[model samples]
Target: MRIIIVDDEMLARGVMREYLAAHADVEIVAECANGFEAVKAITELEPDLVFLDMQMPKLDGFEVAELAGGKTRFIFATAFDQYALKAFEVHALDYLLKPFSQQRLDQALAHARASLAAGSGQRDAEAAAVSAAARDVAATRVRPAERVLIRDGARVHVIPAEKIEYVEAQDDYVQIHSDGKAYLKNQRMAELEEQLDADKFIRIHRSYLVNIECVARIEQAGKDSHQAVLHDGTRLAISRSGYQRIRAVMQ
Candidate 1:
């Protein structure tokens, strides 16, 4: 299996390479010094596995995984245990604490190989469970968004969901475009759809879901897609399947 080692420290990367070299089935494709480099390498090389480091200069491992979009199985090699819970939350295959033993590294490799063989089935199951649990939590959790919560740096600004014109998917995040500015949230389009009021927001495409209240016009695009022009003049394409659903609601 092709693998990439991502660590800010040169020594960590070297150590991982040495440990992985003992495995005949594993081949080191490249080594990255930071999360941004890791992201670029993963996108271009499309390695089967990644030896990810938790902390890096610019992006960090969590951001890297999010950017990768589950394309590669991640085996986190970190000195810190604090990120273990968050790593699993992202469905990481394994976590190898720093100063790891060859035996421990081997175990992580075994788990990663098994997970790769299962493809995305295990991930899908985990996602389903998470979704179900999130539903339960949402039921009990206080509704913080009478409007919306705009995550600006370390602080969160709550705005009304009704004011949201539309949302666009960017990698693992969704850009919540409202009145004049856009807010970035760590969420998927599908997840946001479930949380938002279905009556007010409608998914117009795989990458976009818009507030029906903010839709100014629907223009024909092609045989299998249509463009929705929002009140803010943002043009979003609607897939044939999504267009049908939107049309059904309108009718």
Candidate 2:
């Protein structure tokens, strides 16, 4: 099994590396110090499994898993057991809480081995499970997200929630417009909307979600039709239902 160990802590990496050395069939492909490096390595190496730390600079393990997709299996390692349920919900092979014993690491690896051998039918199911879990995780977040993380290849763009002027849905993706720049993120519009502050962003149309603070005014488009005029002068149509939703928030 080819593996990558990702953690911001040097000692943690060393301990994991040492523990894995006892397994002759396993090969450690890379060690990443942060989530960004982990994403880059995971994309490049396509390892059989990853030992990912939850807390890291740049991106958290959950963000890395979301951005990396469901190709490689993961066994998240974190100090917080609060994430264990979420990790399993996303179909992660397993997770090891911090300061785990060598025996605990072996158990996680055994889980990964079984999962990988379960054939593509099971893999497809796991992928679907992760997709659904991602939406649940977003909607149930303790607080509305303060920022949005977008992965562009190996690069990550962190856009503060307040800077997001609007989001436009394009099929399976949502185009996030912020600071005069547009970023395409592979997420459903409704899912993305759920992650943002509900009080600040309103779905003005099936295709568009706008920041209330960015709206200049609501203008009449035609008889029984209305549109949102943004501070930047861009206009977005508001559906009858959308108009009702926005109107309540606007008032």
Q: How well is each residue in 9-114 modelled by candidate 1, as lDDT tens digits?
A: 9988888888998999998998999876777788889999999999898677877786676557788999999777667545677888889999999998998888
Model 2 agreement with the true structure over 70-148: per-residue lDDT tens digits: 6778899889898887885556888799999999998988888888889899898887887688667755777888999
Assess the local accuracy of residue 6 in candidate 1 as a C-alpha lDDT between 0 and 100.
96
Question: Once model 2 is optimally superposed onto the true structure by TM-score, how far is the C-alpha of residue 49 displaced, in angstroms?
Answer: 0.6
Scored by lDDT, model 1 comes in at 0.79
Could you estimate the TM-score for every candidate?
A: 0.58, 0.95
Q: Show how many residue pairs clash in every candidate, following the order shown.
A: 4, 0
lDDT (CA) per prediction: 0.79, 0.90
Clashing pairs in 2: none
- Write down the TM-score for model 1: 0.58
